[model samples]
Target: MRCAVANTTVMVRKYERMSGRQSWSEEEMAKAVAAVVSGKMGYKLAARTYHIPRSTLQRRASKVRYQQPDDPKPLMGHYRRVFTESQEKDLVGYIKSMEKFFMGVSRRDIRELAFQYAEDNNLNHPFDVNTRMAGEDWVRNFLKRNPELLHKSEKDYELEPVNFDQFYHFMCQSS
Candidate 1:
């Protein structure tokens, strides 16, 4: 029989013609076992030479069973919220009121108020408290939601500056 190795064929017939009932000779078994025991050759290479699967060779080589490492833990943090239509309207109203009370409030304050009102009424709003940018954002959103407020300051006489006598007369008339 011929055995092929690296494109070279060597003639050897001692272990090539074994029948189905035939078992490995002591010499062949010893050489194969010694090669596996040496640990220098990888199990896949050894198993290929001996005509067995790498997994079976590995199982026969060691007694302990193999197990995969545990999966990593999920990230730690809060989830975002999904507001209903009514809840969204309420939030818009609250933000508008806040804008009317304090012009040019920071976005951080608006975001905090969103979260606070949500929490107070057992709702969920998922804005981060520590990182909101306020400056122009607060005014932009407030105006977008309450566009009438912009006209109030621009066209309404109530927002105009009045003399003390006129203011006194208006106050007295109202009282």
Candidate 2:
């Protein structure tokens, strides 16, 4: 009978299935290997021509040794710290000591002053001049420790009345 589904007029023949012998010739295998090794055709193209998977071709190709170019060296540079602990402490102390003279001075002013002090004293501190500003922690700690330094006047605040108990309480509560 003819098969109508595939539009074929050939007669259908049925029989027990049998395994076929390998038909791949040595010449064809050799040609495929040569084409892949040539480097002119990519392994993918070679695989397509040889009716083999690209990965299989790649594995075969990988067995061959190919020299790769050396990688470029990375750029070298130094990273200097902005401030040391000792420098930070000195800066904090300087600001606290000069608070009466520079009461209305902002953090920026304090930092500039610290920079000037460093420059004047020829202090070989590793702090970047841009980041030497005293923060609120420094001010709070300084005030807490030296409570007698907290003196309020109608004109300006002065470091006079050293209140130890009040300072201790303030520090404890804050902590």
Candidate 3:
């Protein structure tokens, strides 16, 4: 019983130390995998040498000799999201196009768009019918999902290329 308690205490202390700490980086993990792959050391020894988790070493090693599929796991886009994957992409594009035109879209604009988009597409979601708008939670989730739209500097954004010749022709026609 005393030995069990001591082991538990040690585990608790280890957890406390490991919490919110980056003990090993990607380079170190790669080197550890390399050492194991080249028969220089076993997983247990490599993990100890690199200070990385043994399970992490195993996972990386398994992926090293195999090609991982390009299948991207969706981030909460399937369940509980206001828009489907393609729909969200369209909305993101709309938001980005507005940014390109130097027009700022507000939170209210997103909510209204959500309501309008659903109505137009006949999408059945539990949005507020009385206000003719989407729920605040939906809007918040939308922002979180599309983080690139949040706090992105205007200068960092690439505006659509302008055609000067067409503009000059239009201006000449008007004069």
The most accurate candidate by lDDT is 3
Off by over 4 Å in 1: 1-81, 124-175
For 20-129, candidate 2 gives per-residue lDDT tens digits of 43344556656666787776678778777877666756765665424223212223575332334465555555545455434533434443554555565575444465
Question: What's the best-to-worst order under TM-score?
Answer: 3, 1, 2
User: What is the overall TM-score of model 1 with all chains considered together?
Assistant: 0.28
- Alpha-carbon TM-score of each model against the true structure: 0.28, 0.25, 0.41
**Which pairs clash (backbone N, Cα, C closer than 3 Å) in model 1?**
107-134
Candidate RMSDs in Å, in order, are 22.6, 22.2, 14.3
Cα lDDT tens digits, model 3, 1-175, are 3454443443344435637466689899889989987889999999998898999898888777452353223355565544677778877776665556544556665676678677766876789899888888888888888997787543443343333234323433553
**Best by the TM-score measure:** 3
Candidate 2: lDDT over CA atoms?
0.51
Clashes of 2: 3
Tens digits of per-residue lDDT for model 1, 102-125: 443334444455555555556433
